[model samples]
Target: MVAGGGMGPDDEGISFAHALATLKEQGSALLVVGSVPEELFAKASRTMLGDPDADPPRRRLVVTPEPNPESAVRRLRETGPLSAEYARVISRGERARSAAVADSFDEMTPRTHVVDDSIRGLGTTIADVIEEFDLFAGGLEPAEFRMAFDCLPTVLATHGREVAFRFLHVVIAQARSVSGLVHFRLPRAVDSEAVGLFEPLFDATVELQVDGDDLHQRWHFRDRDITSDWLPVGDRP
Candidate 1:
């Protein structure tokens, strides 16, 4: 899982493109959960669909509670990986109203599900979250899917920590049953005691820190070796 402290501006530089690329190449389903949907899209664009000339995944599903899909497409086109290509694609599809259509490139567009929280008579309960996953991932092979839970803190805030924990427990089970990769992001600013509850849920923990032009990342494989390295932002790995 790609967990970050998100304590400062530098913390935003954390990159999980490598992980996403690996999972996609393995043909896995992906679940990305985040408070800010745009950031999630940008991450996917940079890593999973970074190669402007490469093909899009067969089933890249993105579910969000946000309303403006067009803004998401704009974010990807302006700042995501292959920004120039995304921009060109948007230019060509200027009249398209949906992000899936506007963001489509090289003939591949991810399936996007937008759950507007502002809608009347809508429920933002934990069950609603799980239901969305089921709708997108039901019957899909775990090995063929990779999911990202961008930030659980938001869920925790909406529903009590206990409820959020139970929800994740169920989600993780489904992911493991399908052998799909599950990546989660949690802010470091959360209570240390509460954060401990997530440790056993994840196999490994990764930390990313930005120092000047260099991005430093450390991986702690529980009960295994720890690896740390630095990468220059402008230089490709």
Candidate 2:
């Protein structure tokens, strides 16, 4: 898991996705918590999927709480990934039904899915988010899928600890059910007391700090067999 403190919000998602892309060897699913801007999250998505030439077709899902899902898709188009042709966008944000963002990917434009107004959309409440997650998780086949949550601090701050804890517990269970890897990027600005509730839940944790143009990272693990130290942002594990 990656925790963003002094590190820029954009870097938090980008770095997390960069790491996950390098480490993922199987199908994956991403659950973005909207802690970072839509543009940065899109970059992270592009990074996580990698370039078409080096990527194999894998089951993948990109879920977000943005009002305009196209905002995420457009940033992805800018990444120049040839595989963008395979993407489809689903808009569930009730504030806007259509993705008004301009696209440069031509035929690679993403298709949209809209939920009826009768139902709640993303970010309306913690329960709504959990229900949406369950719907997404249920559609996945029984296989390995890497799951990343951009920033969980938003959840805890929005609904309180109990709700966020239940949400994480459900998400972790969903990931473990298929033996998928789960990583969450949480903002360090949150109360350390509140953040403490999540540290023990992860098998490993990473602390991210930004210094000028450089990023420093430290890793902690439950086993403590691996030695880790502050490393350059782009350095691979």
Candidate 3:
């Protein structure tokens, strides 16, 4: 039985269509297919020939298989049988590593493990991590969440907003991942709306609602829409 795989996600899969396309790329070609189903032999003898065993008038019969176990084994044992003529493939393994490998190929993109570790190591509560990384929501104590939150900025800085946010959808463990509307309350008085705004790559919906003596506005990322529960941006501001 056919088991396992050997195709990458980018390659899609091995199919007759892809094989044909590869041939066309090389130039002129002709594909010949043959199968020895019982019905064809009977039909050819009766319809084309006046007699059951008679040969057809304008046709040549080139029997590909002699109806024997040896031929079947020979036909099936294909590793690179037609490598020069019609390229044959044995197996393909599929994996979701294309985006990651391609992204980091030129040293431009970060690795998958780097991203995964970044999120998981975020010092937030274990509950928060289980929520984000594990994609499950649970009650975590304040101290633990604070522990997890400590790693937020470093994680964001290293990962960047693009991949960071996509992963944060699971790693954030709170409303912040999607529509939770969270940010750092910059104590220095920057727009709270501007917390995760270092790069426009991340579609952060947080809006800063800075108010009086909020000179400490730079300390936390305030939600412009609400004046309550504004979290610290980097455990600092």
Candidate 4:
């Protein structure tokens, strides 16, 4: 079931903060589909990770395709301070591509797990890494963990739609089992048609766009046939 919060429709629109709070409170899988700036993507990632100072303190996992380990760490640092124990990264296929990436992972606080792109093995490796994080949480509630799958388009292209779908199905199931909030990023520019194919796998889908200098986002919640108006993405409440 979808997590409930003060996200009900109002005369204006669904409050972005309220919508996000709902997802964070309960474990849910979300798909973010759009073509927007990298900075905006970072903002959405930060939102999924939630406040670092939260009472229970959320653990974060970022699955990225970035080949440069330093660059990936930098981007994550932009989200907030990195706690080696609470934050982790699954560097997909980057370890084999660069020696530097492999060595860097060994020396990072937000420990990194490097895995190859084999379609058959990728899902297992990711699930294993998440399980490691879950164990580290010491049997805390699922809401204590958050994950960001930052390379949906790359995975789709590398494994094809059918294979990618299967992989996502497994990952989403893992998320639900642990009640962890997980989100996959899909840039519509890569394959717009793929959105519909994958939307059913997620509890909700967030559509983002840019209009001149402003950025806006609309959320389509699956459990409830509710869609929020395009509201400007602003500072977190």
Candidate 5:
């Protein structure tokens, strides 16, 4: 893309040509971040298509690239671990954040919400949160981790509230397992009504579990870790 942008020769800067050549030798990703304006092209050639018009006759272009990422995630979650490809993609939080976020809708899905927002964004879901606690007696740290939804929220009350508990449960599951902090970075779409409900209540509740003490705690809801208001509690000063 750099060379294609026509980096000048006398500028002594490597053009997209050299960059592309080097990239071919050492395989790596070429991410074009944010967004770019759409370009128009003809079927004449691949490299040099039509120089897109500044403002062309805006005709319709029906191109079926693929279903939106949400559909793809729905299929992946439905398939479960059998959907290793999708899980693998999930494990790679960077590429998959967008997909996970889009599926943040509660009625539609919760598993993907746990995997993407709860796991990747908050840096929870893995036993590695505390950096030294290890289960499996391996002490090898968590190989890979995420909040896999064996079930959904029984009662969400509202969309935001559902998403909140959804986020909290995943962290509680992982935190109680080994050693880790429940870091809550609320999703942009967190139900506003539910936001205050939990936030003001439990933001200060945090501690380290040593010697499997969590196993004895009497938790409310699904498990003891189920918090009515984790983000608010965790976010307290």
Candidate 6:
């Protein structure tokens, strides 16, 4: 059975806040799989990171293959406060390295770590950075940390399924060890075969769809073998 059965929906559908709270209460690290439009994903990421002003502030890490760290920071800031210690950005690849260096002048921007793809593979670089972040926390509880890996498709495209699978295996173990909530975004529609290939790595899979101005999501819990009804993405509580 799922650890938190009370989170199951009624006839009316589930609220965004209730779903998030249940996930946190599940007491183990979660690997949530999902893909959505970029804008909606960003909003969901912000929600998952929690309110900056909320109690027991969380440490956030964003790993992106995008070239512009500034643009990422700007998008994050659109939702809530982003402090240097509260959040860190890992800019991956050659282009990102250049962009991160150029954007280093702003103290207000989240600290960016540039990982050059030429020197190290994506899996190694991500693992190393996550280790460093963990070490830097120095005894902070794992639940205090959250990570958003924004480029699974890019990783798969660059390294192929076998390599991406190996990378995810290691990274998911890392997240579970720390008891952190970490999510990887695919950003595009994938066939069932592909989903089946990656489904075992995650605790839950969230499928998202857009219809006109309404955004909806459905959740699947692997361990309990339960799938949620499609619920509208509402404002964060």
Of 1 and 2, which scores higher on lDDT?
A: 2
lDDT, residue 64, model 5: 11
Better of 1 and 2 by TM-score: 2
lDDT sort, best first: 4, 6, 2, 1, 5, 3
What RMSD value applies to candidate 2?
9.0
Q: Write the per-residue lDDT of candidate 6 for residues 160-205, one digit (tens) a residue.
A: 8998887888887876676677777765443466677887887777
| TM-score ranking, best first | 4, 6, 2, 1, 3, 5
> How close to the true structure is residue 73 of candidate 1, measured as C-alpha lDDT?
42
What is the per-residue lDDT of model 2 for residues 163-194, given as tens digits with 9 covering 90 to 100? Answer: 77766776666555554544566655323565
Higher-lDDT candidate of 2 and 3 = 2
Candidate 4 lDDT by residue in tens digits, 1-237:
122454434522444445556765677898888988888877766766667567666667788887555545654565554666677677766543565444555544456666777765667767776687678777658567777888788888887899889889988888777778888999784246789899889888888888888887778887765676676875432
Show pairs that collide, candidate 5.
3-16, 160-191, 199-232, 202-233, 203-232, 203-233, 203-234, 204-233, 219-224
Candidate 3 Cα lDDT to native = 0.25
Task: Tell me the spans in candidate 3 whose CA falls farther than 4 Å from its real position.
Answer: 1-117, 120-148, 174-189, 192-237
Model 2 has an lDDT value of 0.45
Model 6, residue 15: C-alpha shift (Å): 14
Q: Which stretches of candidate 6 lie over 4 Å from their true place?
A: 1-22, 25-35, 78-83, 118-121, 234-237
What residue pairs clash in candidate 2, if any at all? none
Best by TM-score: 4
User: Each candidate: how many clashes?
Assistant: 13, 0, 34, 1, 9, 0
Provide TM-scores for the models. Answer: 0.50, 0.55, 0.23, 0.81, 0.23, 0.79
- Listed per candidate, the RMSD to the true structure in angstroms reads 10.3, 9.0, 31.7, 4.4, 22.2, 4.2
Model 2 weakest 10-residue run by lDDT:
117-126
How accurate locally is residue 141 in candidate 2, as Cα lDDT from 0 to 100?
Answer: 37
Which stretches of candidate 1 lie above 4 Å from their native place? 1-58, 69-109, 116-143, 189-191, 225-227, 230-237
CA shift of 136, model 2, Å: 14
- Model 6 TM-score relative to the real fold: 0.79
After TM-score superposition, the amount by which residue 78's alpha carbon in candidate 1 deviates from its true location, in angstroms, is 12
RMSD of 5: 22.2
